[model samples]
Target: MKALFISLCLSLLMILSSCEGRTGYLDEGQQNTVAMLTDVEWLVVYVDYSISNEQTFDDETNIYSFGRDTKGWTATGSLKDPSIKKDVRYFQWTFTTENYAVIYMAGNSTDGYWMIEKLTPDELWVVITASDPVLYPNQYKTYYKLKARKRQ
Candidate 1:
């Protein structure tokens, strides 16, 4: 019984320590990256979510922004642009990793997996992957390239 107890304790310690090892890469750059992402509400300028379709916005009027706070991120505007009836006005967002995030939309509908292909204070690039309910055995994948809107 004592031997079994010691083995369990060692196993527990190993598991906890391994988890801590994952955070060693949180340097200044990572903080800056997150800060840049959360700081501004980006405007979508170009998109190529489909294999054949490419979409662009002529002006910032039909645009959206991502504003993140203590709770999480809030994505508003132009959600309908990418696809029909998207009309996503407000939703909660959370990052799964440095390069990936997930969005929780209204009615328990998840927008899908959001991947950050590129990020900068001036430019933000993202790709979202979701399933298509309308099309059986198909998925919805889109890429968006955005730029930070000039502050008025």
Candidate 2:
């Protein structure tokens, strides 16, 4: 009876040890991505419109902020556009994939999806794509590549 009790206790201990508690609702990769995104204020450094072939290399004052709330994340930024002017825009953001490779933003001024091409502690590159035939007549799909870096 003593040997059996010891064996049972050891088995229980092994099982409990194998079951590790989750750090958060998000997986490790997603948590890392979120941490990287929220850790810095991103400043747009480059922009490229695929259809128009327009590339802007000039220093941009646009700053992007990603809130860290796992339940209701937000993406806010100020865009300096001649047509739109410099207005602070707000959008709810979320990762569409389990790998956290894509980000979707929806708001009045910005409504699109961005595929994260590269993400690092200091730099981020995303390919923005949107498709709205009714809103954007004659345009089937549009692609915009944006590169941003952490503000110094």
Candidate 3:
């Protein structure tokens, strides 16, 4: 019994050690793609997804606003359903030094994060990917993948 217990402990340690720590996933070029992601202000081009019933619905409802911080450098933006309420909420987001990035929204804030899975400068498009949040953080949070064109 003691030998079995020791084996279980060793196995658990090995599994945890294998968990990779979070690191920026950007390449040099991809890093440039997001340079302005947290720089200039971004307006809502479209919201690619919304959470409902543990399901993600691609919501192209362009009736929204999203922008990066100019000063404090915090993730700042507001979202609303004009059909319902038009209140913008301030939230925090994380931008990776890597090409891939995420915008975290949780609490009275927003309970989740949005990751930029892909960005194409030539096409002027960004592909964001996120997961549905269930049973809290354990389940993937809602994904608000956004494909936006720089606003002039």
Backbone clashes under 3 angstroms, per model: 2, 0, 10
Best by lDDT: 2
User: So what's the TM-score on candidate 2?
Assistant: 0.61
lDDT of 2 at 115: 73
For residues 59-102, could you state the per-residue lDDT of candidate 2 as single tens digits?
44456667785222223343343222245667677777768887
**1-152 in candidate 3: lDDT tens per residue?**
99999999999999999987655355666457556464333434333333554222243232222443312212323323223323445554554324345444443444444545554442223333334321133543333333333332
Q: lDDT tens string, model 1, 1-152?
A: 99999999999999988785646455676667767876765667788858798988774323444555423323334433432223445545655555333332222344555567688898877766764222322566688888775432
Q: Give each model a TM-score.
A: 0.57, 0.61, 0.37
Colliding pairs, model 2: none
Which runs in model 1 stand beyond 4 Å of their true positions?
A: 1-26, 60-62, 70-88, 98-110, 131-140, 150-152
**Deviating ranges (above 4 Å) for candidate 3:** 1-27, 39-85, 96-100, 106-108, 121-138, 141-143, 149-152
lDDT per prediction?
Answer: 0.58, 0.63, 0.42
- What lDDT does candidate 2 reach at residue 112? 76
**Position 137, candidate 2: lDDT:** 38
Candidate 2 has its poorest 10 consecutive residues by lDDT at 70-79
Ranking by lDDT, best first?
2, 1, 3
Please give the TM-score that candidate 3 achieves against the real structure.
Answer: 0.37
